[model samples]
Target: MQVNATPNRRLVVGISGASGVAYGIRLLQVLRQIEVESHLVMSKSAQVTLAHESSYSVADVKALASVSYANTDIGAAISSGSFPALGMVVAPCSIRTLSEVATGVTSSLLSRAADVTLKERRRLVLMVRETPLHLGHIRSMASATEAGAIIYPPVPAFYANPQTIEEMIDHSIGRVLDLFGLETSLVRRWGT
Candidate 1:
């Protein structure tokens, strides 16, 4: 597939069924603040996670992005390697999604898009949000890394001295956005 020669200010955000749906939501909000176009795709299980984690309905969260695609939409524009995008960030990526991307056997559009990102040599950040991971999870993460996907566990930095949960979320997401060369004021630099 021929990649678009023109550079575009677009980023793909995938929210999977994990504990931290807030990360994905905050990412979209920040991307909008930075004026970068965001393409959002949420896994079906994410709806249940979202309900338990936050009051925001799925539509409310979807409205935060520039465009939204269904997980079942395999033929979506972002699923194509030729689709120009900075890369994809699977915020709160579930283990299932991680395994699929690692194996290149994507079932949903979210994982398919991630695979496309890796094939296109674009950044694919997986914000894996599980605790007490077993050997399988660790191995999957390593495999994904070997396949050119970044396994970014959203561990908070206490050095930032966050006063609120929102601050902590922003700080972590800010660092993730850095992978795409996006700088935001949400990040509190060290010794500054």
Candidate 2:
């Protein structure tokens, strides 16, 4: 397939302990399919969640992206404002990560990179994966949104009539990619 001539876009994907590990993995897959370079980072809890949700190992998850950084690697390129990434996404973003980013608490590389993205005025999408959100969660989401981060919960779309997990994952990731100005045909349109 002929790839687009546009400059290769850089995307930073952070995975947290949230339940939707499949979203992060599938997002990487779609980015690779489009020939975009991905920078992947995962929290320690995310590793455990991935193990419980899928057969892939941490190394396997790392292989999905062009570059992988340790969650504690604060010196990683993506953690710096100098790094010119097109955007960042924290799929399956846990409440802890959300709070950290919202408050500018750089406990890990994930939150630091998110802070960099916001400070640099780049797209930051958080695919929060919790159910029955409380007031604290709502406040965190509002805080991040005020700082220019897009909070996208993994709500299923009935319009697509998803029949499988992969389809649902694709739909969510596709919408997230749209936030980065990437077009995808993974999900059907509303007026179609």
The candidate scoring highest on lDDT is 1
Superposed Cα RMSD, model 1? 3.2
The true-versus-predicted C-alpha distance at residue 8 of model 2, in Å, is 6.0
Tell me the deviation in Å of residue 107 in model 2: 0.3
* Residue range 1-192, candidate 2, lDDT tens digits: 222223237788999999989999999889888778888999999999999999998999898888899998989988888888788999989999999999998799999999999999988999998879899999999999999999999888988999987888888889889888888888677888
Lowest summed lDDT across 10 adjacent residues in model 1 is found at 1-10
Model 2, residue 114: C-alpha shift (Å): 0.5
Among residues 3 or more apart in sequence or in different chains, the pairs in candidate 2 whose N, CA or C atoms overlap within 3 Å are none
Candidate 2 regions with alpha-carbon error over 4 angstroms: 1-8
lDDT for every model?
A: 0.92, 0.89
Q: 114-176 in candidate 1: lDDT tens per residue? A: 999999999999999888999999999999999999999999899999999999999999999
Candidate 1: misplaced stretches above 4 Å? 1-8
Best by TM-score: 1
